[model samples]
Target: MEFIALDILPFSVVDDVCFRRLVEHRYTLPSRSYFSDVSLPELHSIVETYIHELLAMGVTAISFTTDIWTSDVSPISMRSLTAQWVNEDFVLRKAVLHAQECAGSHTAAAISMAFEKMFETRKNPKNKVHAVLRDNAHNTTKALEECGVASLPCMAHTSGNR
Candidate 1:
């Protein structure tokens, strides 16, 4: 039940007979409120621990990708940050660093601050962030410059308003 909701699935999934049969009566799903109060926070903690473990794996260089967007149904804009790295085994690894509300005005400074906050906990000495890949918007490019890191334009940023 908790993992369903965390994965952005419907909470009522556990109510399905097929799902219950799949679990085979070995576990009872917790209520929505119980999941909210206990399971969600615990799961977040677990993920945080996992992220730390991943970052500590001596990756040499990391990159970031980010975007901000708003919905027609809501008056708020949100930003998502993703981290990319090549591991010791030479496999590319990616992780979602954050999905957070873009507070204050949508200025270059504000977005720069958002980048700073996103990287607050990812200061592994073994890894160096090479660049941030983002859209080629005026504000976004300016924000990247303000963050003082090398910035690369995303190849798919063809939409003018993005």
Candidate 2:
């Protein structure tokens, strides 16, 4: 299940002949339905808990990066939120807090609402946010302002910076 999630592979991959043969030699493969209906949720919960634990352990501040993009194969627009911070061990760590599909227009209000929801779901206090790195879209800038969080333009996206 972790492999499927990490590789972004379809749950049905477990049913593939080559995949089954490779793993069936030493382990039993569960049905695709089991992975999709049970293991996926369990994996998500475990990862979420681990991220929370890491953040709670002497992490003082967090920077966030957020963006929205449309899939080439589909009309789905996904908004992603990622958090970065230095841990107690002095190691820089980052986690993708959310990558959810957006239903409507990518307006400032919509972007702000999505960011707030991601923070709320992770139980992260907005006060802990140091800054948000984002694309130089007017809506993105306005959204950060609306949320009262500092915003930095993503240098990679700036013209002639890369």
Put down candidate 2 lDDT per residue, 1-162, tens digits, no spaces: 878988999988988999887884778788989998999899989999999999999888999999888889999988889999999889999999988888898899988887788888898888889999999989999988998888899988896455
Clashes of each: 0, 0
RMSD of each predicted structure: 3.1, 2.1
lDDT of each: 0.77, 0.89
Model 2: ten consecutive residues of lowest lDDT: 20-29
* Model 1 poorest ten-residue lDDT run: 118-127
Question: Measured by C-alpha RMSD in angstroms, how accurate is candidate 1?
Answer: 3.1
Tell me the tens digit of each residue's lDDT in model 1 across 47-103: 878977887788668888888987899988999978888888998889887887886
TM-score of every candidate: 0.82, 0.91
List candidate 2 segments past 4 Å from native.
25-28
Clashing residue pairs in candidate 1 (N, C-alpha, C atoms within 3 angstroms): none
Residue 125's lDDT in candidate 2: 88
Best by lDDT: 2
